[model samples]
Target: MRVVMSVQIKKNASIFEMTREATPKEIDDCKLVYCGHGFFDEADIQNNINKNLMD
Candidate 1:
């Protein structure tokens, strides 16, 4: 039997606070920002990548 690790960020994460960047507007006031699940949905993934790379 093997045990697997599951990644989840749950409510109230402090990881971002340690970083320099202020909470982005996209994540609902930074409180519920990262839940460790799906940074972006399938639809917006391409757009975000393009914007970051192109612009």
Candidate 2:
């Protein structure tokens, strides 16, 4: 089996933090902000292509 991961970012006032799962609307908002620019999805992670964003 393979492990899949997701990321959620939250902002309060002027501070931004990585928290937990967000609502569908939040995800949609992110999609708009980060339209392109080579973002990875669940399938990309599973296939082991460009998986390391920190690299």
The TM-score, computed over Cα atoms with residue i paired to residue i, of candidate 1 is: 0.26
Error of 2 at 2 (Å): 30
Model 1: residue 47 alpha-carbon error in angstroms: 0.6
Where does model 1 exceed 4 Å of error?
1-41
lDDT tens string, model 2, 1-55?
2222443543321111223344578658754222122334556443443222222
Best by TM-score: 2
What digit string (tens of lDDT, one per residue) describes model 1 on residues 1-55? 3222333342432222222233465355644333233344455654644454443
Model 1, residue pairs in steric clash: none
